[model samples]
Target: MDAEYQSFIKTLRAGHKPEFPADAKSIEYARLLDAQDKLSFLRANFNIPTRSPLRKRALDGTVPGAVKQLDISNGTKHVKGDAKEDAPSIYFVGNSLGAQPKCVRQYLNAQLETWASIGVNGHFTSLDNSPLTAWQDMAADCAQQSLDLVGAASASEVIYMNTLTVNLHLMMASFYRPTERRHKIIAEWKPFPSDSYAIASQLQWHGLSPSTSLVEIHPDPETMYISTEHILSVIDEHADSTALLLLPGIQYYTGQLFNIPLITSHARARGITVGWDLAHAVGNAELFLHAWDVDFAVWCTYKYLNAGPGAIAGAFVHERHHHHGHHHHSTPDPEKGVDVVGYLPRLAGWYGADKTTRFNMDKVFRPAEGAHGWQMSNPSVVDLACVRAALAVFGQTDMRALRDKAVVLTGYLEWLLMGLLKDNFGEPAFRIITPGNPLERGSHLSLLLRPGLLDRVSETLAAGGVVVDVRKPDVIRVAPVPMYCRFEDVWGFIEVLKTALEEAR
Candidate 1:
């Protein structure tokens, strides 16, 4: 851990105190402080960006590389800026929508000019790097980073591609085989709506009604997360009839990091095809899609990946699934065990019209090998460019180090929130719905607003320039993203939240 980060952790633990909102009673500040201290120590090791200019200056005053520069605006009303500010007002509410990355625009601009000047010729003539070489050369690097983030063994099993759900539907088409005995699918209810619709329709296409065809695991009414044990039990009970297990790597609303390896391993052991929607966890946490033996997985790159909005997403299919009997290779390379070229996807395009013999084009669709087999269409160059730029930065750092820092930072934030609750609302007033253990969650904390005070507290925080996201009726989510969120930001957010609570009252 960096000394500066260590110091920040110590300060957050011992120095900052949670302030109680007026009109609240029966809270214990001291006990909360002790818990906060322990959490601060845990997260005191990563580079978290601070939005406060004053804090940044203070943090950088002594340490040389204590801070990082991001072009974010600081406005109380909109939380928008071109430069970091003191206590940035513009909270990133739309992480589910997209997170702004400083490098993506520049990358996209460069690609735009290439496309404009050379037209199709840019495929071979682009400056610095040729367009044809782009996917071939860059694919390995991009795939490697993505694989690392997702916990894959080799880059061979992963490939960058189209949007998230698109890849999901594609992988489903190939992997999902419904029979009379095991015709049902299992997934979370209301899973991003699109996933729900897709799965429902998949069952419907097989002449199965959603009411009986899909098993949705709903959260307990009072809690925001589902239990892994409960899910496993459900699978076991339905193992005979459950044909597939489709789950999100992380729950979008609660920010819960599911026990993916455990669940996937269990389901695979029972002959169930397992796939994951990693929209929230792709870059936010550590994963092992290959080692976990996940039959297939897909994710969008815009969120934690720092890729700009609409950036192309990627998917992974275990290499084991591509060899031996399935998707037999043509003149398969005997040396590499599996033909690398054979695994490369040849989607619906003129290029696949049997460059050697046009008559072969008459054959029915045969899926590509490995992860590339999941691709349905070519990706946008601009989107690929943006993702490449963002991933370039990620390549420079250690993902494990980042994950360690994130665990601590998010834990610290939760500790601080707990302190605020203890000092202000007291027991029975409000409770945290996010898991208490850091291992069960990610970088965000879901604070369930007390009954009757949800709107007021959230509104007060927003008005006072405290940037936390609200999830409808009650929950307030605060994410101290490790890559860009700072320790002081955690402290400052809690401080301002106290004031906001007071003003709300």
Candidate 2:
């Protein structure tokens, strides 16, 4: 084993936290925490962007706050400086896009080689001379790696296929069946826009007005966090009319991790099918779709899963839903021109047909088992290759271990941010909108800045080599991923943020 790997194993055996003073904001204290970190070595497995085009001019002796004119002589170029090229940027934007894994290139190259040598034949053949299945089963292979992360019972319960919004629409097509009595769809007040759009459209498709058919549960005005009681109350209030309940596993803007199992169970008991948009929670929070009896769920891989931008996303359907009408096959209703008496009516494609008859060129659509049945088309090989590489890293360690580290790492960040407020400003420059309780949130922290200061503060942090994302008027979201981020990165970010806040003032 390599020295770094050995050191990581040793640290894991010794437990994660160090005996550093909780209130200490020194670099030495951060280094002490990093030394005892079990997931620190995983940082080397990723390629962190060391320098940004935005920061190059600053490094070339340009004034700190001065905006340099871009010399677009040769399509924009930066003059190299003596800046430390090996130092990684303090990347706290994993909630948006995760840092690329170093192995993705290797994985992509292998697929490219296969495509070059075998062409169309590569679809049914293995190129690496391995005993694994062919490229035809690539989506299944990718889903296998993610089963544990989402707490799925079997591989068939999950399949990586379309993007998050696309999958949300697809799942809603089948799960959001409405009748006269149960026509309402319940969701959070400010879900991710895509989810809100899809849900509203689905209701409109059913010929119902969103104003009456769609129910939204808002956060407590004072706490800015949605209480479980509030969500439960909404479900109960609409129980008689509710046909479906769609919610995010984690609220994107506030960084709130909802109690999914509790909410799912409550909705299911009320005869309402529950589905989750897990784009923010899939890799960041521990999930149990099958155990929770969640009707369906969707998530993207680019954020916490470390796949490239717009990479293939994932979906889950309970096994019980899979065999609902298995013994009975659908026949077209000659009168209405649709199959009215079958399992869940879905937007079907050839790719979702049973494997045995998939290539048979039959007129009848015999759906495949489980979540695989929801695939509308063959997955993009390049996208699946990226997912494969990311999941390979996930296979090295389980989500349980990662979550354990996350609580400590994120807790440390919360601690440092609070201390920075107390020590520097002696007043609130910003308040963390995410729940203060560790169990109520994930890795991301949403800082709600004082009115009109969000953009300026975010820009200052970016100029100072800290990468975080700002959401509209006043929120800045920072997520320190456990796979690649270190305690030192957290410490450096806090220091840079202090300077940024001062500059903003």
Candidate 3:
């Protein structure tokens, strides 16, 4: 740790919890905390322009204070009105949806205006003189960003598409071709509801019973996170009949960064087609899909990527599996019990027309190279514009610098929460379900509230204007997004949390 950090810790340990302004007291204490480094890092890494009109309005200076003072009895007040103090709510639900960057609105508006002026002929308009409706290149650009995020070899191997479940279903249609002998799809026991449902539906569509074809991997009885070693062992045990292994890059509930390389490697070695749900991993962790030889993966851009809710999602197919210029290396072997119809289903639309004569023909279908081959419908123009705006920030920033900042910010948040929990509720009031090791956890910390305090604590925190989210029954997920969240935010969160706990008691 740096000297500044050590000094800050000393000040924090001195035991004088900072005081927040009474009008919006919950967030004021954060200013007293030594969060300069964390805040500086965010300002440095993200293109958070303070002087821009878009940013100025999005930030609405002083709104954060109002958020800190909000009461839940009033009901989700952030959207209720124009209260400036309500801005710094210390949002922790990046796992659900990320706060919008101030710049995205301007970007979207530019596109909207361009569309309005050019009308139906916007495709060949003068400004850029490029086809506005041509989503092909947009898909390619998003693929490149997703590739860098997941360590894929080429842009062609990835594709941007609909939401997580929709993309998962599409990939399953192409990859999860199961046979009677090796037809089981192995997934986490508590996999996100959408994933579980999609996998079940895919199996049912193939005339197979989910009970016999779906394999759910459970963690040890009392634990929420799965053990990497155990997952590999299960794959080994079920290798004979396991056709696919679908796992998440990070467990959403536990914030556990699973051993992607090891797990995917083992499954692939045993002829299992491995895919990943990266809803929680895409922008939070470093990945190496190409190096790891993962068959495919999908993610939602709304979370850490800061794309708007229900924004366009992304998918990655290993370059080895993509037929960019050449033919597919080899069809998945049938002995592995993966079924293939020997042809990709065709699309019926003007965009799907064969490129050579597409302009002259009303209908034709010519599959593009690699993962682009998977695109069936036109991309969402608005969503792509927002994502393009977000990726522009990444273009200016290095992931390594962001990752370094993340380590400190998240670690500090965890440390403060544990300390506060110990001081008030004693040892076992709540447990950090997110791994203690930095390597095992990502930006979020999932705190498992003590048995009976879950409801009251959650309700109290929201009423107190603490913007963390709770998974029903026990888990409270707190994310200190390094790009936007400050160390002061982390400190303030703990203070409010302690007050909430006391109030609950």
**TM of each candidate vs. truth:** 0.76, 0.88, 0.81
Per-residue error (Å), model 1, residue 105: 3.0
Which tens-of-lDDT digit does each residue in 167-269 have in candidate 2? 9999888877777888899999998888888988888898998898999999988778999999999999999999889999999999999999999999889
Candidate 1 total steric clashes: 13
Sort every candidate by lDDT, greatest first.
2, 3, 1
Residues 324-426, candidate 1, lDDT per residue (tens digit)? Answer: 3324345643322234444433234322232233236546445544565454444567677777777766665656766766665665566666667777643
Per model, state how many residue pairs clash.
Answer: 13, 0, 12
In candidate 2, list every pair of residues with a backbone clash: none
Report lDDT (CA) for all predictions: 0.64, 0.82, 0.69
How close to the true structure is residue 203 of candidate 3, measured as C-alpha lDDT? Answer: 89
Off by over 4 Å in 1: 1-87, 90-98, 129-141, 324-368, 425-429
Writing each residue's lDDT as its tens digit, candidate 3 over 1-505 gives 2554545334433422222223223344344333445436444333321112223343333222222533434333343445433245656666677767655756676677777876655444434633223444566666776656778788777778777888788788878877778899999988888898898898889898778888888987676768888899889889989888999888988888898999998998998999999999888887888899998899999899988888988887776654322222336455633313233432234443334544675433444556676776677778887887777666656565566666666766766665566566444668888876677777888988877888888876665556777888888999887667776667667776887777766
Candidate 1 weakest ten by summed lDDT:
57-66
Ranking by TM-score: 2, 3, 1
